[model samples]
Target chain A: MEEISFASQLLQYTITGITIGSIYAMVAIGFNVIYNVTEAINFAQGEFVMLGGLVMVLFRVTLNIPVVISFPLTIMVVTVVGVLLDRLVIRPIRKPSVLSMIIATIGAAFFIKGAAMFIWGKDPFDLPPFTGRNPINFLGAVILPQSLWVVGFLVAVVITLTLFFDRTILGKALRACAVNPNASSLVGINVQYMILVSFAMSAAIGAVGGIVITPISLMEYDRGAMLAVKGFAACVLGGMGSFYGAVMGGLIIGLIESLGAGLISSGYKDAFALLVLLFVLFLKPSGLFGSAEISKIRKF
Target chain B: MKLPAAREALPSGRTCGECAHCSSSSGIRFETGRDLPVKKSKNSLHLIGFGLGLLLLPWLAGHVELLGHYMDVMVFVGIYSILTISLCLLMGYAGQISLGHASFFGIGAYVSGVMTTRYGVNPWLCIPIGMGVCAIVAFVVGAPSLKLRGHYLAMATLAFCIIVTIVFNENVELTGGPDGLAFIPGLSVMGHPLDSIAKYYYLVWGFVLVTLLLSLNIIRSRIGRAMRSIHGSELAASTMGVNVSKYKIVVFVYSAALASVGGSLYAHYLNFLSPASFDLFVSIKLLIMIILGGMHSLWGAVVGAVLITFLNYEWLHYFEEAEGMIYGLIILVIMIFLPGGLVSIPGKVRSLWAK
Candidate 1:
């Protein structure tokens, strides 16, 4: 056996960090989408990711469907779940406060997770890598083929979202609704429809993240809570509603986690991200990219 | 500018002082604008009746074999009552939401459990020490987090809780890691070890009564009003000369201390401590207890705790795999249909009858 050089170790950590960070960014984006329009944190956001992974496994593994078909099928299934959540859990509230809405979402999360447990069972299920399991050697560093797939999926999401938000009329209307629902309604934009769209899109995005990461990290029913928390940490670090901020926050947390696990103790890896979250929150409540003035005005 | 003037002039609405028909000494009015249903003497009578009922519970259970089997469960109810009552004060009154209260409860359990096991410290003496530790930790955690409004504090507290649980899990040598600490000595009065379930039940209920009495006193005091004012509106509370941040921190500390006391009691009574007991799920369970019982009153806390403890420990065992689903459904049904919680049920029934 050969001794690995320090530079390669650093590169290995970087590769690992980027892979995990991409997933966190995806969850954070989902959080931001609903939060922008509703001013309520959807606590069940990570369950979409979990559903994506499990549903994909059901299609690709159990049914032996092709990856191409399974991917879209998984996303669609999760999207329906998101739509149902909006219709059933979210929409029916007569006068929703931030607290009530948050609690409702939490209940929804528990229900979804429990339902998944009943459907998928307590044991963790795995998805084979999109590509082969061969380790790719790059600049003396070893990276899994699936890590590349994970990073690629995140890139593809960002590009698609960027185009959707910038070029599409529906996207612009969604933005208008986010800016001010009352004003958007007056301008004839359907605020309720936009809210529904946000839930669908966020759920779909979360599904993709779950699909891509499943090969690397096994899919389990109860993993959503941890992912949601870490994703929330990314949101706070990146500035809650900022897209670029979510990306940066996710990557930074990933890097810290990987580097901390490698350099320090692996047992304390999760704590590193949370510590950074607390530090960011204490020093800068608005996050690095959010405006303090804007945060002060927002209800939740 | 005209709109602002109109809003300011719009009717101050029924001040408590303006309620001329009330015969109470203090000018207290219900939020629903209804007359006070119970007089001061009646309120005292209700308290006495509640105390007497509790006092008779163990004796009544001794004769009934089925009830005797659940004497331990009753003890747990008393323990959880303290935790829920404290949380009700912090969340329902002070308007500070904490998702990490289980951490304070955990801290108390761990502090007491660890100190007694490692240093051979007296089990009874460790209760205050655990509370002191929780108070300091809560102060440091609450100061910055409480400064932020809404879910930010909730998030911060949750983060702190996860961190604490992680430390409990990772620190193998000290905490005994995931296997948890065992052979924890039970508390004793004088030379008598509280070996029997009946004795422990009485002891635990004694603490619950003290906690309930203390909480009621606080709720009827000036500090409680200050807390309620903060809940209504922090800006308004501050303008009215209530030290908003100071009271928030104080209540936060107080709540943490009470949770610690519960934890300490739990540790001594069980004579075993596990990190799993202090996890995020337990924290959420505590939140559910307070929410289900009704957040607004001390008795509501006790009722919520007792019902939830029974459901979690007793009835839910029948469901097994479906337990989590049922618990989730319970939260949804209560939050959606009866947001005021189980404590509001009688009032709801009366309103329906009126209709």
Candidate 2:
């Protein structure tokens, strides 16, 4: 269509893609961490994003509170919800037939989504700008400051998590349980607590993603479903059971989406990650960083 | 990492004397052919009963209170009954979660639409073509993704469904885009188009009988047993040389084809085919119907499908202020307490009544 330099447009789209990708990456990490610990995908993990955005809109927009306060408060509330969910919905069905547990989470997701919609309405909320409203021009390509905030926060969080997982004793205990829960429990590692911690931590990360990308994507009650799909696709493309794979998969999916849009129709761009999901599943099966383990649960 | 069974749990903690589910501390004993198999499958008697029910339905339709609405409700019941049976075949028997099931339904409808509109192909002939196209596409998608387990496979299928909808939405030239195709010729036989709703009623209802017969046969056949085995224990099934992957592929294809058939009939009956009609929500609704019906029996599929269709139109209507909220609440409560579904209730009640 429109006349535009290939290099400039490519560069512009790539930046937008990476910015979007970082959010997807964050959501994937959140899913992977919880899955690694609990062996169940928190279907309501998507709701954490909605909760974060809703809390911000309620506090920052309605009550006119500061962004700094609104963001952390929302994350804390979501973390608490995650803890309660682990204790109730997941704990009772932790035996075998993990499929039922997953279904239970889906039930919980539906309830939560309905509740979110009822409370916040389906309309997209006009999220206030997170950073200063200034565009940075690099080689004649204009970009938003909040875009930098998204990419910066994504990198920072990844680095922090890598450090936490490798360096901290709690992280070690968590990984230890994911590897061998029985061994970890025998070693006084409190596997249940670790699962709860992962859930809470993952929820917190999802909320962070909500706060960062609210300006660009805009906050809405129903946005959780779309974000969840992209995140889930990222997790699948990179590897279901692998943590680091989520990051790479998210970035790759983001690029594929934008580049696919530039090359093909923009409407079909969303299908790119899904195609890669099916492809990687066919070729690798375990994912880029995923370790193959024979599963005992019913394949849902 | 495998904890001992519940009796083993007794040595570790509480015994059957204390635990609610256990009795005499022999552990949570499973029904190893200890109980009677399902005895209430819909049979020739049910066909007779349904025939009577339909005969009675016309008399009921004559009521001043219930006229056109009842017929509309019955038509929906027919449509959803087919959808739910297809889902029960895949999810209940095949042990596969397909979030993109709506795509097959859409393809069937669209194929029928394109055939009738473009090539002027006989609508009856297009039925097989719709089924064929759906089966082939489902195979193409399901075959490769079967390797992925749980959420991965579900997500992949979900992606497939979303992409299909997007294709239907974006390609305006072919699909008529968002506006959807209209004036679909009534499903005719050998060039006779049935124009009236009353005539179409018998048409859909007749097809539904065929669907029910096929489902009943499948569920009672060796193929059905293999599917159940695969669902119950995949590893054990594989060890018994059940060709787990092959059975899954077959069932998935079969389910998709049935969905297509249902879709084609729907397009012709409704005389409109839109992308919005078959979406992820519709697929999930189908899943809900099977679960609600009690996935263990074909009758459950029918009961669930009929119940859900009626509930969506009737019960939810009571909550005009919060219809969506009511639907979500009903789903949650039903999933929690009645996972086997309303179909199980009749037998349970019968047993209780006998006691």
Interface RMSD of each: 3.1, 3.3
lDDT of 1 by residue, B1-355 (tens): 1132222222223332333336244666343411112234545676799889988888889898888888889999999999999999998777788989999998999888899999999998999999999999999999998997776777788788899999999988888889998878999999999899989888888888888878877755567767777776777667767799999999999999999999999999888888899988888888889889876766778888999999988998787788768778877887788877887888888778978
Backbone clash total, candidate 2: 0
lDDT of each: 0.86, 0.75
- Tens digits of per-residue lDDT for model 2, A1-300: 345567778888888889899998999999989887777787777778777777777888998989888877878888887787777666655343544555566666666677777787788886777878788987556798999999998898899998998999998998897777889899999988999899889989998888888888888776776678888878877877566788888888888888888877788887777777668777876777766663333133
* DockQ per candidate, 2 decimals: 0.57, 0.38
Candidate 2 matches the true fold with a TM-score of: 0.89
Give the per-residue lDDT of model 1 (tens digit) for A1-300: 245588889899999999999999999999989988887888899999999999999999999999999999999999999999998888876668666777788888989998999889899999999989999899899899999889898899999988998999998998888788999999999988999999999999999999999999999999998888889999999998888999999999999999999999999999999999999999997898989898877767
TM-score of chain A of each: 0.97, 0.92
C-alpha RMSD for every candidate: 3.5, 6.2
Give the runs in model 2 whose Cα sits over 4 Å from its true position: A1-4, A92-96, A293-300, B1-42, B189-192, B318-325, B347-355
Candidate 2, DockQ to 2 decimals? Answer: 0.38
